[model samples]
Every structure is written in C-alpha cells, then in structure tokens.
Target chain A: MNRMRIGDLTERAGVTQRTVRYYESIGLLPSGEREGNGHHYYTEETVARLQKIDQLKKVGLSLEEIRDVIELYFTDTSEVLPKRKVLGILYRHLADTDQKLEALGQFRSDLQSNIERFERWLEANERD
Target chain B: MNRMRIGDLTERAGVTQRTVRYYESIGLLPSGEREGNGHHYYTEETVARLQKIDQLKKVGLSLEEIRDVIELYFTDTSEVLPKRKVLGILYRHLADTDQKLEALGQFRSDLQSNIERFERWLEANERD
Candidate 1:
C-alpha cells in the first residue's frame, strides 16, 4: 500500500512508534498527513526515511548530522549537493563503520571467552 | 589507585558524570564510598563495571537485562551462578551480537553503494 498508519509504518521500518514520533518532532521526518477520516496517515516515503535514519545511526552519525544529509537521499537530484561535501560524509561514515566493526569483533571475542570460561567453571564446580 | 573520586572515575572510564550518577541511582553501579573529605570515591572495580555496561549496551542489551547478568562478570567465582541460567544469558547475548553484526554489514554495503552512486553522478555532472 502507498499509505499506512503509524503502526504499519513502524512495523515496516522496524523502528518503534517513539522513534517515529521523535523524528517527526525533530523535523527529521514530516508529520503524517491527516486524512478525511481524521486519522493521520504516513506514506511509503515515511517508511524509507525511517529506515535511512536507522542505517545512518548504525554508522554512528548523530541525529544532527543525519538531519543535515537526509534530504539528499530523497531529493530530486545529486547536482544540488556540493561535490566534496557529500563525499566527505560518505568517507566519514565508512570510517565510522569500520571502527564499529572492529570494536564489535573484539566484543564478540570477549563474550565468547567469557562463555567458554563459564562453561568450564560450571563443568568443574556444578554437580549434575 | 584502588580508590578515586567521581571525576577521576568518569574520566578513566570514558563516561560522563551523568552516566556514573545514573548507574549509581539505578543500582547498576555502587555508590562511591564517602570519606572525611565528603567527596564520594569509586574503585577500579567501578570503572570495570561501567566498561562492562557499555559493552553490553553496544550489543543491544537493555539496562534491566544488563543488570540481570552483570554481576557474573565481577563476582568472586562462577559457583554462585546457576549453570544453565548464566549459559542462557551468554548465549542470548552472543545471538544478539551476531544479529547486530549482520545489520551493520548490511548498512555498510548500502552506504558503499550510495557513495558510489553519488561519485558517479558528480563525475558526470560537475566539471572544473
């Protein structure tokens, strides 16, 4: 469907209602259009915006930075964006993503060790 | 030093004073012990606890969920932990971390594609 309610939008975007409301309040997302029945309805574009926001967040862009660049994603053309500026944002995001990946990899290793240690300790100390 | 003031603790832990205070208020961290100086003091263990909380948060564990399993990391020995329960929590965290890794990988891929598209468009549209 081209139009949906907040519940459907959130379900489709994989974000919470609070997130949608917060984004709308902060101007990162447009407020849903009110229909003739007095119910607010969001379009598929809203779902895409929410998903884009989520993706940006995963790369550690602050909401302010996301606000600055989000329109480029949905806007009519890339010619409007300054050449170097857009590339700068992309490069920074790539760097941020790499750092996160490294950190998460380290964390996963640590978690695994802790798990193994617990298993060994349980085997030694816990009686069946 | 075994004991440090809150300022030092926050700096060492790379967390904000607000985070330290909130953790203390929520019983997620021990309130710093007070001495004759009237200023509260935290220990190295407190720093480690803050770090553990951060790691757990990065893997998407809620504060409540973190509380349920945090002590296992700091407690004296593994015997006190119920064998199956601790294993279950560790397994769940591992699964959560894996899911996060996958999502981040997807985000990274999408970002790369967007960057390439912008680059190509800029090359075609902008000239010196």
Candidate 2:
C-alpha cells in the first residue's frame, strides 16, 4: 500500500491542508498515522475518500450529512440490504438537489427581470 | 421626513439590525443620526437601500460590486451618458448571472447521473 505525507495528500486531493485538518477535527475524515518525525502519513485510500468528500460537497451535502453517507458506505457490505438503504438516502439527496436547481432557476429569472427594469430606466433617461 | 430607529428600519426592511449596522460600518450605507442617548435613527431611505442590497445579493453581486452600483445610482444624473455607462455595467453582471446558471445546470445534471448510478447499483445488488 502506497502511503503519502500530509502535503502530498493535500496536493493530490486538490484541497488545502487546513481543510483536510478541519475535516479530520470534525470527524469527517479518519486520523492518519504519525511518523517518527512527528509527521502524519496516509494511505491512497485517503485520496479516494477526499475525492468523495469533494463530490459530496459539490452536490450540496453538509459535513454532517457527508459523514452519514460515509458511514453508510463503510457499514455492513456483506448483504444487499445496505445497498437498498443507500438507494433511499440517494433518492432524498436527489430531491434536495432538484429543489436547489429550482431555486437557482428562480434567481436567474429575477436577475433577468431586474436587468430589463434597468434597461427601461436607461432608455427613458436617454429621451429626457 | 419620518425617522426610525435602527430596530424599526431593520424590521421594515426584513433584515437584522446587525446587518444594517454592518452595512453602515462597511460604508455601503450611510451612518444614521445619533440621539442624545447615542441610539441610531434612520430615515425611510435606509429601508429602500436595504431592499436594494438584498436584491443585489440574490443576483450574486459582491459587496464591492454592489457599492459600485449604488454609486452609479447616485452620481451624475444630469446626462444620459451616465445611464448608458450603468447599462454597460449591468450587461456584464447579466453575463455573470448566465455563467452561474450554466454551472448550476451542469451540477444538476451531475446529480441526476449520480442518482441513476445509485439506482443501477441497487438493482444489481438486489439480484444477488
């Protein structure tokens, strides 16, 4: 198993070292091994975990929610029941994302209408 | 010329008093009148300004950019040329909003694809 220092892990994961430490502090990430020189070392699995964290954040999961998802990923993989349970969680997340997209669409329309109002003001001012 | 205290202004504008004070501290809003006991009093204009700030925030304008817009609203209305200049600024903001909507649309698609992947995994696991 290839191991990496904290710096290397942060660089490979495209997250700041401070963010990685914060995640660990919040229990969103696992603690790493301490070397003889007091440096931390992590396995390649840390990289994969960080990537998953980034993906979950992009999908709008809070750290607490991501922790829940991570727990689901690790617990009881010997049966199909866990996968079915995960499907239900994912479906709820899907609905949340859809709601977010709907809100964004509404904001976009508001911006358009405001722009039109400003344009009309400009046009009327130009005539005066 | 009806005057209101900070609390009244915030209540009418649907923002917290702290937010109104922060806007004043940041120079995005003018400082209010100070009473004999040192309480701040504001006019109805503060209410309109807070509403404008809220609308600009919804459209994703930074405080600095919103300050610029506010300046444009206040400055040099004697000529149509200033209105034209403001139109240019608003056009740039329109482009930025469009870009944000595009990125949000992309994220929505990614969420949909992830949901499909989870559904497939659930189906495969159920068969086993």
True contacts kept of each: 0.54, 0.43
lDDT by residue for model 1 over A21-86, one digit each (tens)? 898899999889987887779988888888888877765567988887787788864557676787
Alpha-carbon local distance difference test for all models: 0.82, 0.73
Off by over 4 Å in 2: A33-45, A48-103, A106-128, B1-3, B32-45, B55-103, B106-128
Q: How well does candidate 2 score on lDDT at residue B22? A: 86
A49 Cα displacement, candidate 1 (Å): 4.0
The DockQ values of the predictions, listed in order, are 0.47, 0.28
For model 1, the docking class works out as acceptable
User: TM-score of B chain for each model?
Assistant: 0.79, 0.66
Q: Which pairs of residues collide in candidate 1? A: none
lDDT of 1 by residue, B23-127 (tens): 888988878888887889888989999998997776556798888778877886454767788789878878877877887798778779888988888778667
Per-residue error for B24 in candidate 1, Å, reads 2.1
Model 1 chain B weakest lDDT span, ten residues long: B76-85
